[model samples]
Target: MTQPIIKLNPHLFFGGNCREAMEFYKSVFGGELVLTLYGEGPPDAHKDPKANSEEMKSKVMFAKLSGVITLLASDNPNNTEAENTGQFGLSLEGSDESIFKGYFDKLAEKGQITAPLIKQFWGDTFGMVTDLYGVNWMVNITANRD
Candidate 1:
């Protein structure tokens, strides 16, 4: 038997703001955005009574932004506040310094910069930022090791 190829994608959860966050990501990454509201799903699909409420119905049930990178997100049905546990962060690494620097700058807008993009002892430019949505991101521009 042949081993099946696997692809891991990040799925983020938002508190009633999945649509807005996904839209922001689309703007940053220049991706195609696809969203499905809670009310847009089949009537029988949702088992919770509150899912029919206008507020809940307007929330994004599913959102996907596909571009250079693919991101999937959805609004939490329970409306729990999003928190950053500092357990993990999405990392973007490439050799294109300008493009990655641009991303680092844009993601830092209205957000906190954990680390400024600068050359490290490893000979690569690296930085960290927590976006306005509270999502952590790491950008690394690899230097030619040769």
Candidate 2:
């Protein structure tokens, strides 16, 4: 038996605003945005009698930003708002400290910085912020042993 390669990709669910959010991310991350709307989704998506296909035709059913990293998102079927902002956060770690800090700064634009980028007890530069998309991000640069 061969071991399968595994990787973690954060998936977000939004209430009808996924397209707008994904566009914002494309601008920030400079990635190829592949988006699908409810009207373009699988047969089941269009088959749901409760689903407002016409109104949600422009809404993002599934979106992916593929580049250095891949981010995925979709519109919530229930059309309900997220109960809490602290549900989860994406943690980014990179080898280059400057690049990591740059990402942190970009993510913090027009957003709240819970923690400023600074040296942590573990000797890494770390910070936490809630971005304009209402997604939490944690940026960290590993300690330099050399």
- Residue-wise lDDT of candidate 2 within 5-106, one digit each (tens)? 998888888877788777877777787999987777555555555455566666777899998788999887676454335678989998798778878888
* Runs with alpha carbons beyond 4 Å of true place in candidate 2: 41-47, 80-84
lDDT of 1 at 99: 90
Instruction: State each model's CA lDDT, in order.
Output: 0.86, 0.80
Number of clashing residue pairs in every model?
Answer: 0, 0
Task: State candidate 2's TM-score.
Answer: 0.87
Pick by TM-score: which candidate is best? 1
Residue 118, model 2: Cα distance from true site in angstroms: 0.4
Cα lDDT tens digits for candidate 1, 7-125 = 78899988777887888888777879999988887775777766667778788888889989989999887764666535679999999999999899989988889999999999999
lDDT of 1 at 101: 92
